[model samples]
Target: MSVNALISNYFTTGALSDLPSDHFIDGVFVPSERGNRMESFDPGTATVFGDFAAGTAADVDHAVSSASAGFALWRDTPPARRCAILMEAARLMRAEADWLAVVESLDSGKTLTEAYGDIHGSARLFEYYAGAADKLDGRSVNLGNDNAAFTLREPVGVTAHIVPWNYPTSTLVRGIAPALAGGCSAVVKPAETTPYTALMIAELLIRAGVPAGVVNVVTGTGQEAGAPLVQDPRVRHVTFTGSVATGVGVMQAVAPNVTGLTLELGGKSPLVAFADADAEAVAEGALWAIFSNAGQICSAGSRLVIHRDLHAPVLELLVKKAKALTLGHGLRNTDMGAVNSERHLAAITAHVEHARSRGVEILCGGQATSDPETGKGWFFEPTILDGLSAQDPAIQQEIFGPVLGVQVFEDEEEALALANGTEFALAAGVYTKDIATALRMARRIDAGQVTVNDYWAGGIELPFGGNRKSGFGREKGLEGIDAYTRAKAITLAV
Candidate 1:
């Protein structure tokens, strides 16, 4: 679609036109009790695109009450029925993939291609969970001769999902699908920056015959809706994805309630390239790894640790690819889009400038950009910073932008040390042709997930999570459904 046509359609009649400007609760869309509502803006144009009700404490009370009421019936329903409903939801997601992709692209400032991948991944997650819903087994334990013991998995009554704006569609599904599969009612709070896709999915789940209060969506800022929802005593479990600081705050809020938590906090993930690796392939993967969503990813490969022999060749290839990337509005089929928000843009720009001030070499780009076609948007150049100490903020912090820091290591031990030097242990990747070297690095990387030859290689079947400050608990695969349930032991004596 043309840029002008996309702007006109989205501003007047598109996904925003079809969305309900209210919270979804008890099988219906209703206005929020709080009057302090905020409008969502297009990251590409900074245009006010849509508005929704701002939720409050009272709203959280009402939603939790509704979910509690629905829990009784939902938990009693057979697991096969739950699986069927989720399967239908997955079908609907594929049917509406195109529209949802466009909606995600405009709402979150990611390229259209990346948005499509997120929507597709959302469907895959639901489908995988649907198949596993009925497969959760409880083991039988042999006790005394007179007694028979067995265990059963039971759903935690209500769950709250606080998803981030980076990949709103996939992140929202990543939390809600497993809860539904485990027969638990959920109240989802999508990031204020990108709530449209969540609202759309809520409606789709309802249309697939989800029971009243089985799924609900509350839209508002963290201060208003998120805090009250997480702090609610009735909410049994909480899954959040965002910055580490905000994640700590969430943990504190849920501590009183002792709610179950699964957090995917941001990380300064490292990508290590060895002398035996393919320079061109690693460079391409590294570029896509860090810049695909304009570098707004929780596990982005922001830190690059390269072997000295391959450093110059890989750096050159990366710079060439970065310069070749085209930037514009997401709907215009560009390689990159806006930076989600002006505040985020400023933070990313500051990191680059900080590196420059400290006498670091910027191999490629290191500034903000405003194209004439998309005026007044938050955009930054794909940046590469070299010759920096390991303790530098650019190397240790989570920039969460299209900024990559390069470090040269003399040997394998030095490479492993550099990769494990950071406080984060969410994810890491190693590129090498030698199997022994790849396996050794993978085991010693000190990350929850280590991809051998590719970055972000795992799928929905594999458990994805982080360690240390990156947060805990697992999402995706069977572990995801297990997180929403608790085990109960039953014994019978003859």
Candidate 2:
């Protein structure tokens, strides 16, 4: 069916009967061992659309045991065969992109356009890692005569992926694809709020020739499903993407086991615009940087650090453009969509209210709103806070909403200070006409990824992760697979 047709069907009936609502274990859909279930809400409508299995510690144990066995079989599979299976999975994902996109939009409350991009990006991740499956080459060294030394890259056995709600499809795929490609079996614990897409993707992998038990998914709350999976000693690696608090918890859970870990955490990233930058372009970039996904992104450019000369003009343009943005259901393809949940909506409201109380100027929008037609969804206005100081909580902490805090700087040094003032160092953007200035800012910024002339510049080929409190390790690019594999030194005597 066409994308429009699918969307129309959803709004007409408010039900998607075929949506998977069971845990996927050993390559098949199964009920929770405890017969427990959890409801998933449609954030756009603030209504419960579906329910899925709420996995328990027993379920996690079952999935892990299945994965352990699967890992042994997959590890011995030829790399060429592994590449072929992953490539087929990518093809299947593309073939089903429209359906997956609609599901993602409904599940995550992102606009259909963004959901579509995420689905395609997920496919691209599979494709990228498929090509790398057979290329995990080791190195050879000459120790001396009659002796040879080399290194072997091998899979790290069973892996557990703890996925987040924001950017559900892409984030889940970002971690699992490389691990699967590297011959490791995965037991995914998708965020309880967004579990369908992960289960759907696992089904697609099975259809594309992945063996039973190689890819399993358990759905439930973090405490129930995620903790046990991470704490399991049999699981060799864990990749997590979420808030700093949760990442820390995952670290604590995995510490006893001393398992391999990769964390992509929260951010309060800045967008630094020099005086020479095009104000109009910088304004547009700012809109996309923070407002996309309803500003639920971890690496969102939530802080605007602009040169004093460009600050007024840039803020003016940003406020004007932000006001013009349309908010609605994800299926409607509006300029912006609802926040993920009512709880998140309340959090955003609290952030804005606290800022207002502290005398931060509300340059444009700073109120909680709802969908214009139904007036039911959890919506927040695209807000801009003007008189923010480095000490303000809004400037120092991650609001995780469509709220931008404006700060002015007199020179490059001041701009850098404002950009790096926050505890986060995930991502940043520099807008300037001068190459030297752009290069210098990129070098000096503490962020993991620094985009020049644009806010979200690079593709999946770029390594993405953070420094400091934003968490460690990396995802995407060639480095993405490194976390899932380990190196072993081999010596030969003749």
Candidate 3:
């Protein structure tokens, strides 16, 4: 079926009348400097559906120059005016939410429900930051004597945003919203796997009164476009969401320039269920945490650390639930969707194979699927594994698929040790009826974000990020704006 036909039947709404063509940079849909093109594949069909201009290093340089120039004007624009424009952008985004959701689902191979939720979250992020635009103020410091001291919060100039493909729509906006709110121009490198939504957003921002060059998007490989954007002297801040290795590369590229950074990397997050926890509820939480988006999520709770007494019941429930999920095309309103791409599917399969070699028990699903109804899409069954040690590859490394590894803990101490064992400290989940124990575990876990009694207990209002190898800096919430701004001290003699 054609992309349009698929969306028209599945979306049952006018989300996207048609997909946009070309990249948006410097207020125009211009061809790439390299004049190269690449095909975007639909993971559901394992077939190319759209072609996009492949960005180059030259494009990145031009984008940086444009953003630097645009920042000069935007930095001086009144906060109220910036806020107004951001609010308008939010309105426009909500107005086309259905279309945007469809495009996002098509590009990223996520379920339509998940894609729409991400679109809504993106709009809410803009709205939240729009309110913060005018309220971003520095503090006044007291220095004794006849001297008066105060500080002013200012934009950090041009920012480089390297967004991942899994949650492309949300991640792009998550970075852009705050940077724009702080009056910083942005050079965004959208994941080549998913660039359509970003392109349309750039156009909408311009229509909402964002000046030319304020938001430039380059779509291509990280080496050609992303690296230059990070290394460019003009980019004052860099925010990236991807694997740990890529995040490290971004850090190295931006180190010489002393550019500010917000890195949201991968995680092998643990979901702990205590003896007192509800087995069904914890099972449900684990399913949503890891199986959602086919477990491509960075903060997916793929590692389950359960109390010895509760492990069997929770494991039983998890196995049953895993086997029951209806998997097919993302647009089909199925319980689960295909893995993002074939390469990703292969890596996931390898992990399971390695686990088997290590004598790990396959509690439930473990292999990739060839669903007749789903055709050639890269689909993996929601899998659960048992008898894996803490150091096992499947337990330690990030599979980034619908695979969950189980670990039994005799007590709170053991659970804490197991939960905090890995270098990753991204997000963790705790399920227990005892409020005191939940709070205690939340504090002990090394993860940046911890959920009590549920997998995702917080919303956009709360700050989220990771520590250690999971990467530093926060996204979402009031603290997020700080990533894009700097403080300047001002003093007056009285």
Residue-level lDDT tens digits of model 2 in 443-463: 999999999988999999999
* lDDT digits (tens) for residues 190-221 of candidate 1: 99888889888998998886898988889888
Query: What tens-digit string does per-residue lDDT give for candidate 3 at 450-473?
Result: 988779788888898999999999
Per-model TM-score on C-alpha atoms: 0.97, 0.99, 0.96
Residue pairs whose backbone atoms clash in candidate 2: none
- The reply for model 2, stretches above 4 Å from the true place, is none
Q: What is the C-alpha lDDT of each candidate?
A: 0.88, 0.93, 0.88
* Most lDDT-accurate candidate: 2
TM-score: the better of candidates 1 and 3: 1
What TM-score would candidate 2 get against the native?
0.99
Model 1 deviation from the true structure expressed as Cα RMSD, one decimal place = 1.8
Model 1 reaches what TM-score against the true structure?
0.97
User: Largest TM-score belongs to which candidate?
Assistant: 2
Let me know the TM-score candidate 3 reaches against the reference structure.
Answer: 0.96
Colliding pairs, model 3 = 15-98, 15-99, 16-99
Q: Show model 1 residue runs off by greater than 4 Å.
A: 1-8, 11-15
